[model samples]
Target: MIISVRVQQILLLLTLLVIGISREIIQLELWALPLALLSGLVLQGIGDSKRRRKWNIASVTISCLSLCLLLRTQNPYVLFYAIFFTVLSKFLIVYKGQHFFNPTNFGIVVCLTVFPNLSWVSPGQWGNYFFPSLALSVIGVLVARNAQRLLTAFSFLSFYSLMLLTRYLYLGDPLSIFTHQLKSFSLVIFCFFMITDPRTTPRSFKGQILYTFLIALTGYLLQFHFYIREGLFYALFFICLLNPLINKLFPAKEYQWAKKI
Candidate 1:
């Protein structure tokens, strides 16, 4: 419904990821509608009305759909509410010419307060929680993730894990902490899905790398030692404040890389 080529391309790829992760296809479908709607709204609002935005619509649609599937939950309304709040936050609260929080991060925070007991899955909760994360590994990291932003995502993941690993060793129980890190499937998913949001991150490659590292480092510091539950959301929220300056700070190289479909 959004566009044609890009939407189809991303849909096929995302569907492949979902099928790879689940035995029951219908369970994943429950999350599709609301997510698609939310992404559609975002893309459509910013997109042109006359001609189609081939890859952009497809990218956003796949991203939202993949997030829903990777989330492995049934509350479409929660995701929708999160999307609504995120968009509202972006336009509503500008501080020194920048919005205070990434819309998605704010939405997730809102969800935590509103639906703590809800079956929301976070990929960061590892250890005994490890098994549930494999799906995310395949979809969130491998497929749904934007390749450009992944380096930053992985940098944060690796650095954050290292901090946790350090804490475990410091506390004299390295194995225990390592095990707990394994169950953090949602954290992994969150990194690829939420942290790497194009609208939030810096535009240049180097800046994006730096941006990713900071977000990851912050998330790690809060999660491992300070025990801040809202690290991911906080990390992304603050990082987004710097997104605008990316183009001004770093020159965007237009290599003949993106093949026109």
Candidate 2:
């Protein structure tokens, strides 16, 4: 039962991604989705062979779907390149056998930076549908809890909220403005799903808390100080470079999906 936790998460995310298409939550064309999926799967399969490892279709599927959700590309070639690089990053970039940056995030960041006009992120595309937002939050919390990374998720959110509050008071922003920002769909998806990725995050409880706080701080600064809309993704991308150092300073057992089951 415990081992099925990740499988559950994949299924849930896949369902949501598909539903997002039908419900117009994700405004991507039909062809782009298939192209991205094929690109991710094919690249991962070839990469796995080079390393002489068996394929993990589940992980590849999740990565592909996640990229589709976050990256908005009108060109099929652009989508393919985004997913192709995302899959390749896992094999090409490594530290002590673990990929530092989240694969989906790495791909999204690269596309947005390299092809600003071609590929973009619509952070507010998910919109503020009350019931769907509540449902996603609840399921995300459950998945994070099952994965035993709830501490990271909670800490990031708590620190992020506190920072937002402080900024509101300092700027004399309207209470309504503060309330609206807190209800952001992007923040919900990021805190619960993206940042809580057990593989890329710290192994120790203390380390996880510290890592999440710093990510929150960096994201806050980027968003407010620099006015970078993709601040949260960039924060995680740069902070991931410190994963090895964090593991060395606060050593803990590496998390394994199979063992958890």
| Residues 1-261 of candidate 1: C-alpha lDDT, one tens digit per residue | 434434543665465455545634325554556565665566445543322434344444544555454343456666666555655565566654445455556666666667777635444323245555666565555443355656667766777777777777778885966777656655665766666555455657787777777777777767656877666666666666666665458756432214221
Per-residue CA lDDT of candidate 2, range 1-261, in tens?
A: 454666877887778788878878798787977887777778888988888899878888888888888889888888887887788778888998888788888888888888999988888877655566668778887776544567777899899989999999999989987877877877888888788888899888878878998899999999999999899999998888788888888999998765441
Runs with alpha carbons beyond 4 Å of true place in candidate 2: 1-3, 129-131, 259-261
Instruction: Provide the lowest-lDDT 10-residue window in model 2.
Output: 141-150
C-alpha lDDT values of all predictions = 0.57, 0.83
Q: What is the TM-score of each candidate against the true structure?
A: 0.61, 0.93
Prediction 1 global C-alpha lDDT: 0.57
Instruction: Please identify model 1 stretches exceeding 4 Å from their true place.
Output: 1-56, 63-80, 86-103, 110-147, 245-261
